[model samples]
Target: MFKNAVQLFEIFGFKLRVDPSWLLIAALIVWSLSTSYFPEAVPGETRTLYTVLGIIAMLGMFLSLILHELSHSLVARSYGLKVGGITLFIFGGVAELEEEPHDPKSEFRIAVAGPLMSLFLAALFYGLTRLAADGTEIGLTGAVFGYLALINLVLAVFNLIPAFPLDGGRMLRAVIWQMTRDLLRATRISSRIGSAFGLFLMLTGAFAMFSGGGIGGFWQILIGFFILNASNGSYQNLLIKSALRGKTAQNLMSSRVHTIDPGASIAELVDDVMLRQGVSFVPVVSGERLLGYVDTAGAQSIDRSEWGMRRVADILVPASPENTAAPATPLDQVFKRIGLMPRRKLMIVEGQRLVGVISLSDLVHHLALEQEIGTSLRG
Candidate 1:
């Protein structure tokens, strides 16, 4: 979902994206509100009116989500962290920070920002609802605003439940980090708590289902599974980042990289380069200037018959800032950059000159070596 996200807009230098999966949530919200929520709240509204109200309410909720993520991005940026972007996915939105927080205080501030924004939105919507209701306007618009107010408040409260990967969970981790002065330890503790909370939620969901809670129970189950996955993923990511901390791209990059000329045919790349060298990736170059790269995956995209006709340059993915890492870039940061790309690889570059390449395999090997050394020391 993160990889497939489509950029919607840029807000204050932070890109806002929506994953295709988010469309499911949007559709569900519109369906639920139009069929049941608005009809019940407004009482005797036409089907068309209810549909419009539902759409407006869903958009309002989306706006609230944006505000929530925006607040987090702004705070993170204020603390000298890069806000990679915000991606709205199945559960909600996440503000991808380019690096971890430098301290517990920064983490706490960033984590708390989202819920605070939600709370503020809730109050604003409730106030507007009141203003509309006070003037004898008890219609679809008023009900929609009222629903938005309630949902935003619920969002705020749900996010504050001290579950890892959630806003509240980060706050919990921050507090633990502050206390222990160990970020990894703090993360582990928070993740364990989050996993437990997720299990509890799942059990509650099952109970609710048995008690005839219907769709709401299923929703709870879905949320619980999401939280569980997120908590586990958060811990694993921190582990990877921790292992690679302070290491530079130069330290781990495969300097003995294979290269293919821009004029080389894709067929030659496959037979003479990839097959002969047993290398999956090779840089495309013209003398000292780096052009891009070609991998087996890219090669396979061309029909075997057309491989002889296609130039390496034709299939070479042009080097972008995202796909290129400087020698001085932190290894973990390089990993982060590469993960955002489909190829899961990065070209090491200093200016236009290609130096080396790094792949997910390199990262795994480096991490394994670190663990081995740690184990030896402990032994």
Candidate 2:
């Protein structure tokens, strides 16, 4: 994945964000093809021609991955989802959407669209391969075309595996959602399959390693690791979806919290902490309106000696409730938006004056309560 991919870039207005890691992967692919697939020692073939063909093929393959992701984005957009555009990474690509699909039919279309595009590409390459094979002078063209055709065919078939984080897994989720009419159940089942698939890949890779099967085994293990992380995310997302459904910021927020002004120093904050208003995190407010927030955690990031010297305005994170959200933001989303951020509490702003704070503890408690209620209902 990218360290931090840019949101957009103008490439004919169809923005492309290249993941940082994608650059490395693409370079490695190019090198592999240039040296391994194209060689000067081959009889009756020029190294330059093979090199050029290798570059072209690799470029085309990258573009193909982009198109696959674009297909997902466009379909989701047509269904009124907010798309954050497609990103190319080590595993290929992903079209980031703001929320999970609300309708099974919409989910089906979005999931199917990617592999369908790959199949179309496979056909195109196959036709080119056929045409080149008939032409005597274009042996290199035929080989490259043939490779593309076969690669795309592999892509299409591989993605059909019913496991989490794969297109096939997503398709399975859509089908299950349609059949059971339960999104959580569908996600749980599909992701569990994905995790199982990951374990299979890992085990195979380990066997291959001991058997001296070489780099292919290494790739399998790496892919298995990717699957493990991705499926875990999907499972965590299920919990978030559930958390979002039953609660709001108001439901989780602790009311009548203390406040901080822009002019206040960390020294002032440290003094407030001493009062133990039962507050680990405090809201930063100005006038009767809201600004952002300053957590004791953020203050801790600075040198304690500098605490008296630093103003809250210099360190406090300002947030607009419109841009920021109540704990009501899907719990998965809240964690994602505030990744590894200090103090999980998101300030709940109404008209400001520091109304309340919603901490992770609050969301966790609410989720536990909801589970208990559901259990009781079943009983």
Candidate 3:
């Protein structure tokens, strides 16, 4: 979901990525700590000392955030959920789960894992702070540890706030889901509450700004907007998931696929397939086996004069997970894949044999038809 994010490293088979926006937040944290927090907490420290301490503290906070998100990923994996990766963004971090929990209990466990991990880290840092402190002298080490302790406590408490997409909001949704046995209803109620809470925060922030609360007020407003957007997006995603439930790629793909031979010239592909049929992409096959695909872009990449000389195999975009899905793949998963792809399409395959092609337009048409016909796709 994040663009231009840098992959930091991999831990326990989970990739860790940091978005560029996070760099801005990280700099703000360092500056705030060096100028205000550290100087105040450790009096008489030099500017250089304070800066060094701030940098260390920032690094510690980064590790703490990773651990918090890692906890969530680990728990979800235990329940057989596929975690795409952990991404650190402007707000904090998120463990991207490929699919929702199968049941409320799994959901509750997954949602609560982060806060619980944060709480543990808070206790751990508090203990370290106590150990580093002298009887009457709280040195730089003690101060840094104390700050980490408090921040971890804050993170735990902040994430526990009942707002949709937040740990607490998700926990609330899980409880409601268990009680009512309706995941959709639970999500709708929690997301509405989350949106209301976001509105309240924005208003409070506006009041703070007018009352001279300064940058803090602006920060709160930004966070409020993020939460509001995320809440609505989460609800919409659930609706799509509900609509596609029990459906597979086979049900959504267009079986009337137009395939091209590997030896077909780019000129033939452009004129015969693309212009005549108005199709942008055509899969290249050797008998029944899928080799890859050639699109209008690939054909155009070659000069028009050389179109007749270049073959489809020479300009083929190799088939991979990004542009292909199994016939049995869930429609929701296919939908997500298509959204992420530049082509906005996927080839449905059975083993190495191409079965059909599914595009974003096809999925949209299916959803629109369902709504128009008032069809209930629920099992």
Candidate 4:
């Protein structure tokens, strides 16, 4: 979901990234704390002092979020799953686990880790607050910590609510999976519950808005909409992955891909390949060696006037192993790559030779056909 995220730090072998959307939430927290939260709680303090405290509270919140996500990542890694780093966005943070948990036990551990970490932090903060003296500078710090402890405790409890894609939802799914030994069935059940919860949230938010809740209601509605959409998407993607299970790039890839000469100019590519051949992408090759892949989208980056001046190599996306998948690679893995890809395609390679190409369109078409066939059989 994070298109332009900046890597903030590398923690315990996992990269932590801050998405642009995080700034929105961060600003909201800072504003809410500075103007209302801190001012009301710690009266008689200067505006500057309140602002500083707000910032400090904000930082504490950020740390808590990181620890929560890190807990998930660390647990998943301990189970031998690939940790694709964490991204902090408007909805807080998510650890990008490359693959689903192998079993219900693993899933249960991973799902519960974040909330447990939050609860632990809450306890630690509460203990700190208890140790501090009252009516002093240290007491004010303790009060801030106490507030943080409360928020963290709330976070833990809120996350334990069984909603799909959320920690609680995953826990629900794990429990169901353990009972039935059917991951897909468990996912469907949890997702439906999540959708229901999302609808409830939306309705409650609407009612709150009509009753003068204003921004809080609006925020609830936004979160509800996000959860609803994400839950639906999660289920759909699960179905797609299940259908594509045991399938490989060779199952869906197109062998007859048009190749572009590295020496050819962008104008030539547009005229000959795009306009005539009706192909959006062409592999830029020097003999049998795969150099890169060029598309009309990349060509648009340069001025149309410069099309004749620049070579296809200048506009091509570099052929990295990361962008190329083996013919034997699972379709699910290919789908994951396409999600993160700028070009929205993968080159099917056998050793150093490009055997075929798999685009986003190909995978979607394949999945659609599979779904249709399954429906027909069921009917």
lDDT tens digits, residue span 1-379, model 3: 8978899999999999999999999999999999999888889979999999999999999999999999999999999999999999999999999888999999999999999999999999999998988987778999899889999999999999999989999999999999999998899899999999888889899899999999989999998999999999998788777779899999989989888999989889888988899899898889999988988788878999999988898999888878889998999889878999878889989989999999999989887776556435542
Per-residue C-alpha lDDT of model 4 across residues 1-379, encoded as one tens digit per residue: 6779999889999999999999999898888888897777668888898788878988899999999999999999999999999999998899998778999999999999999999999999998987874746445687679778988998899889999888999999999999999998898899999999999999999999999999999999998888898888888978897889999999999999899898999999999988999988898888888887998889999999999999998888888987898999988889888978877899988776889999999988888998899769858
Clashing pairs in 3: none
lDDT-sorted candidate list, best first? 3, 4, 1, 2
- Candidate 4 stretches with Cα past 4 Å from truth are 133-138, 255-326, 336-357, 375-379
Error of 2 at 52 (Å): 2.3
Give residue 176's error in model 4 in angstroms: 0.8
> What TM value does model 4 have?
0.81
Model 3 spans > 4 angstroms off: 127-137, 257-326, 340-342, 347-355, 369-379
Per-candidate clashes, comma-separated: 0, 1, 0, 0
Residue 174 local lDDT, model 3: 99
Model 3 global lDDT (CA atoms, 0 to 1): 0.91
| Clash count in backbone of candidate 2 | 1
Once superposed on the true structure, which residue ranges of model 1 sit more than 4 Å away at CA? 134-138, 253-329, 336-359, 371-379
What TM-score would each prediction reach against the true structure?
A: 0.77, 0.81, 0.81, 0.81
Best-fitting candidate, scored by lDDT: 3
